[model samples]
Target: MRAYNETWIENKNVVSQAERWHRRSLLTDDQLTAVRKAYPVGFQTMNGFLEIGLFIFTIIATGGVFLLFVELLSIDDSSIFGLYCLLFGIGLAILNNVLIRRRQFYRNGVDNALVMATTALMVGGFNSQFLDDGSLWQWCLVALPLLAAVVWYYGDTLITFIALAVLYTCLFDLTLEASFGRTLLPFVGMVVSGLLMQATRMIRQRAYYDDAVSLTQWVALAMLLVSVNYYVVRETNWLLIRSTLRRSGVMSPPEIDLPWLFWLLTVGLPIGYLWQGFVRKNRMLIILGVLGVAAAVATIRYYVGILPLNVHLTLCGLFLIGIAVGGIRYLRSSRYGFTDVPDEDSPDEFLISSDVITAAQVAAGTSGHDQHDNVKFGGGKFGGGGAGGGYN
Candidate 1:
């Protein structure tokens, strides 16, 4: 076997792109040479973007193929198009199976890309076959579960995150009539996610459920962040009234959108999550809390852009720099409230818990940057907790 530096592998786990790429600052000349020659990470390479672009192209290409197939069949009926969805979906699924079963690991990007395209086809086909009523809630009911099965079979975190997003958004849409559910969902999400996080800990204590742990943690943290961030973006009363009107088509009393209440939710709730993170020494909690804080700031910026853009950028930049320094200082100190008891089978999940993996990085000074924080309201797929392996 050819020797290569694994430092890049380790360094890529650092979330900040700066930290991952500027390895020359830390490594010696020999190590740098090794890093340069080493194979790029599967999901973390610059090629990921190229792969994404190609994946999108593939979806479009697949749709065109579906259309061409329909044309060849000469089916003039609009309803017959639904049949096309079924045909195309099955074809894609077959291809996905073949690629996964037969292809080399070097072509995982192609496999994963095909799987994503397959998901779109399957969803469209299922919806066309059954959801003739054009109800989003109904479509979600049919589609989310199927997509969930894809996630399980594929074992992809990205897919898992997507499913959670679909579930959350659809539930939000369905429950908008009650101001309480909308308000409570994300809060409920936080608690539920925290429970999930605790479950990861238990799994780690016993067996270190590599893929399962990573998937669970990323999902939980994403849930926590969504819960905390939603509380601030808008008043629940607005959603309540809108949903009620949509559902009933009646002369319902309008609920007022009180700005004052949102001000508290937008600013205070994140502080609360942050405080809870500090209290529990929960890394995901802290990371979500930080994201919640950023979301709050974004909410404020959206509602109140009183300052000039440059000044806004400058202030935000300064604050982030301070936060980075403060966080590093805190973690380096034994006062690191985010301490986990020394365990052999710890830190197995995706990088955030990636069920998101920052606690290990930000607190314990470890790096596993396979975190999937860039997603919200998605299509779930994963690859066993960003495991570093190639198809042999």
Candidate 2:
């Protein structure tokens, strides 16, 4: 009985020692390192490349715009044909698209392509040459609507805005050039295009507000301002007004000019951009503000140039006053434009609060603020205090 009890105690001691050794082996340096290395990581996404590629494309597009302008300026009275140039530009646009696709990932290729294509179409308009007897300007009246149609089909606001710009330019040419008939086509076309752009934006329900809308509105506003200045200058002198307005169509039974149509560009147009930037939180709204101020200054400068120093200063002061008041109003009402991302599981929708303005945000500026500081905006919020990922 004593020998049996001693044997059982010895067996128990052996089992305990083996278990201790096994645990110690698992805690060894080699085993610890292997376990650390086994954690799963997800880092194969190409988002970095996508961003870099987009920047490159933007630069290329800018260069292309410069080239188009240079070609337009080179045209002379003797040389009438610009169709060749337009065709050449279209070809280059196509080739550029192909190269961009090959060099970059296909994330937003369609969007990029549509923008380039729209640019090509507008450049084509600039190259138009009228071949009628003694008339060197070709009719570009047809291209505006066609281009807008394409933009609408693609559901691309950037390109649609370009189409709108082209239409607005056409309207300017019509009113200033005296081709009132020509203006009708683009006027109706742009109103329709603008509606289409608004509709697409609504239907698609974009997750974020686009800055391009602001830019386009600025372009339109500038055009309207220039037209206004031209009209005001013409009103003071009938002969000059007659020459400027005679380019398109005759009014009042082929003699009297219709002046009311001219104010539509100035009085009604800037309001669009004002709404976008001040109310919609569009960054492009800043552009509208700049252009609006410039237009006002240019108009005042035209009138001020003929006046004495005191009058000029007073005119300038008045202009500044109007601008300041508008700026204050716009700033006070503007919403912080930011994208709100919601969690997949949570019922609560997360949005960027207006209080957490960053340097980037200050730089972007919400409304009525100078573009000196950076104010960061647009990001999702969460319950956790720290950010997490699938892997460290």
Candidate 3:
């Protein structure tokens, strides 16, 4: 009876150990999956919190600035205080971003969102001309370039550069010499936009390309320079065309006869078309480019003496349709190429095939460049492979 009891106890001990091992294996698998799911969610939540916090702070800061201006409306000395609020607000913004970054999150999403929000706020504030007390929003203007430099230094985004360019252009509107020949702003903006596009192509980073999303920014910059040219040229006789348009056939803006704004529209549309054409390098793009240049010339002729709006609009419509056709052709041409084994002496360093590397040990005896490279990493061939050849 004692021997039977001893045998039963031995059997129970073995079964308990097996059960414990089985539970541990199952728990380990569950924990792994839970960790994988939680990591991404945790990062996203952190990013969302920072974005919301920064946006709220900017609004509150702007409000405080507005109130300060209202309070100091009577004194010439109040400009100094308004400047103080602007500087302090900008400082707080920079500090907030630094703090938000210290908390862990998906780094790319956090950086992109914060930079985008900040730039959008700057542009909106510029558009609103936030400080209307005849101060030219001077403090905001001065801080903008500094903000741009910081963006360039550490932001690692294409939008950051584009925002910098726009800020540079905005200086024109803020300047005392806007009435003079200060078309430098828009010209520089266009150049910067093109350079950024090239940088995007070479770097293959999406963040940089996002900055070129400013269609209005491009147009506004162009108009500033064009307006300068119109004033210098002084072709006021074009106003007679408005009467002709009214009498003959088409409805147009009441101020359409003015050469200043109309000439800008004339130059802008063609420049946009030509610029896209040259950048893209398609045959159709080249043709559209010619048409755009021609249209601009035609518009100028109509305004000056000879042609008319209806004819101009017709040619413009045809040019636009051609632009769409060219775009589709360009898209179709950009297909991905096949992955191939790279030439040994070629400049390219190819990524290895995962499948070949996985089963590499079994076929280690087979002489291949890949096996030689694998062995270098201490992944030895299966046969007589020491620590250097066998799986570590």
After superposing candidate 1 on the true structure, give the runs of residues whose Cα lies further than 4 Å from its correct spot.
1-50, 53-57, 177-236, 239-283, 296-392
Superposed Cα deviation of residue 318, candidate 2 (Å)? 11
Q: Tens digit of lDDT per residue, candidate 3, span 1-392?
A: 11012222233333323323433474464553343333322222222345467556656665676567556664344445545444444554574466444643222344444444455544444434444543433644654665555454444334544554455455544543455323333344345445543554565433222233232223333333333233222332234245766677755533323455546745664466557655664333333335435545543554463435666557756876997677666556453431133332122221344334223312322111121121221211111211111111
Q: What number of clashing residue pairs does each candidate have, in the order they appear?
A: 26, 26, 4
**Which digits, one per residue and each the tens of the lDDT, describe model 1 over residues 143-239?**
8888777765665545666676676667666665455564555455567678877866774331112343565676776555555443333444445
Worst 10 residues of 1 by lDDT: 383-392
Q: Top model by lDDT, which number?
A: 1
Candidates' C-alpha lDDT:
0.54, 0.41, 0.41
The clash tally of candidate 2 reads 26
Lowest lDDT 10-mer window, candidate 2?
Answer: 383-392
By TM-score, how accurate is candidate 3?
Answer: 0.36
Give the winner by lDDT: 1 or 2: 1
Task: Please provide, for model 2 over 1-392, each residue's C-alpha lDDT reduced to its tens digit, 9 standing for 90 to 100.
Answer: 11012222233233323323433473564543333234211111123245457646765775586567657766544333355455544655565555534543222343355356545644554445433332222234555655654544333445655566666555545554564543343344445446545654555332122233433443443433443433332443344345645665543122224434544444444455566666765554444444544454444344335776677667767987997787566656443643233221112211232222222223322111111111111111110101111010
Superposed by TM-score, candidate 3 places the C-alpha of residue 351 at a distance from the truth, in angstroms, of 31
